[model samples]
Target: MLDLVSRPAPWHQPIWQQLTAQQDFAHAYLFSGQPGGGKRRFASAFAAFLMCDAPEHGFACDQCRSCHLRLAGSHPDLLLLEPEEEGKAIRVDAVRQLVDFISQTAQQGGRKVVVLQPAEAMNVNAANALLKSLEEPSAQTYLLLISDQPSRLLPTVRSRCRVQPLGLPAGTEALAWLTEQGGERSREECALLLQMAGGAPLLALTLAQQDALAQREKVVEGIKALLKGQVAPSRLAEQWNAVPIELLLDWFCAWTLDLLKLQQGAVEHATSADMEKVLGYMAQKLEVQRLLAWQDWLLEHRRLFASKANLNRVLFLEKALVQWKNLLQRR
Candidate 1:
């Protein structure tokens, strides 16, 4: 069974209550938020509430037959639409299927709901196909669209729905939630995870579960070794074969930003403790123009990674590292 949230996260409680108390519901909702900020969970919970046969106090009645079906992942009236593969575009055929689903009467004799996540993943053709459903509201049918980057979505598509934004939770609230979900993780570890996640509790938990901290430590150590001439960039790139390229690019981008900030005297302290010294030394040695040029190159490749460009990961990493190290060389 899909692990649907029973209710909104604590940070979303007020908005949940407000939405539940509404007299009229929109036919579609666009839930926009950062990843791990509970936008999907909120959308799922709202879908459940919409389909609940016997909603109690603005929440799903778990005892109802409809709730039972949902719990078993066999809810006939509900559909989930997303890309077949991760990081791939949602095809027009899938949106066509959604259009067909929207036209059909509810099998459960109640509301029909569709949850389409990462809505920005829809290509032009797919998004245009979806627009038809948005233009003509089907009776007792609702569509919940979730996106981490709503700006990437078509303006027409975004304008059609009631846009709901979910912000990152307060630091203390995030820390508390992460602590509770962290299992054996110490408070300090959870705090570090939270920092790494940019105060997104669910993401912090996910990173912890993935042992991302250990992975980060390994990468940092390899960088130190490479800088000290103990390891070649090619060797380091090969060593990091198991690490995700997107994550590596993200870290590099972040480090580049930090280096820029330090060089410009924009901040007195480094935000990343693991690379404080490394970034500090680079900031001192590298010219600002060279660093800016490197940042542009890193960002361009990062965009390519986001677009799922078919470049060799090993070669990319080797090239990235060589350029990174060259930034410190005398002009």
Candidate 2:
């Protein structure tokens, strides 16, 4: 209803065409992709199209009554369901509400659209409650489920919907798009940002805007000082506590992988080019097996952090820093 399909992003254009070309659609559809890959944007556009009174070429006509209501954020037929709080589970009560909403006919006398984002946040009971609706959705009702980690969803829930996986755009396309998004980065800078964001265009733009490269530099310098015994693990952890634990762990994971690559004579593929000398020094001073073990630990902690586990953040960082320091002693 917002005319989102009017000017589609490069990666979403094909998906728009595919959706528009289809006259018939499944009751439930799951759009799955990595974080920052634009799956949610695509799903929102698809939802808009479904609710439009006069959709033209998969895009909503903004002049239509339905489009006006949707643009006003008062579309009676459009419902959005997500976790009430960040990193919290979607309870069965929310799913029960959605069930009741779907039971009613569309107020616009058109399609009723429901969007559930980050579908993995639904608890087991909530997911189970939603299964019946997915299995047998009412006529003229559409469910759009968006998830960055579909594997966390129940098999039965996944099996009931048509799944579509979105992938990252090409380097040139992504860079061009990032530039358009006010990134204003040179080619090398754009490439570095893309690498740091794992090739996700929107995320690369966000990282560039947030000066994440400078943040990573500080993190690398902290790790180097900790490993060299110039800074105590406790002190470093205190300093890094200001940063998000998830981001710090991600940087640590990348740095450890870069050290491993250096040890394996794969310097070209190392993540941090500016910190090559420091990474090389660590590679030479730390045992390869110990570095690999540290890598495993970092990955495990990162997974825990992503899942929002209630762990002691300060102690976690201190233990990781201490382990890293111990790795240097083993040489």
- What lDDT would each prediction earn against the true structure? 0.89, 0.82
Summarize candidate 2's per-residue lDDT along 256-285 as a digit string, tens digits: 888888888876546777677777777888
Candidate 2: list runs displaced more than 4 Å: 1-8, 227-229, 266-269
Estimate the TM-score for candidate 1: 0.96
Best by TM-score: 1
Worst 10 residues of 2 by lDDT: 1-10
Give, for candidate 1, the lowest lDDT window spanning 10 residues: 1-10
State candidate 2's TM-score: 0.91
For candidate 1, the clash count comes to 0
Give the lDDT of residue 10 in candidate 2.
70
Cα RMSD of predicted structure 2: 2.4
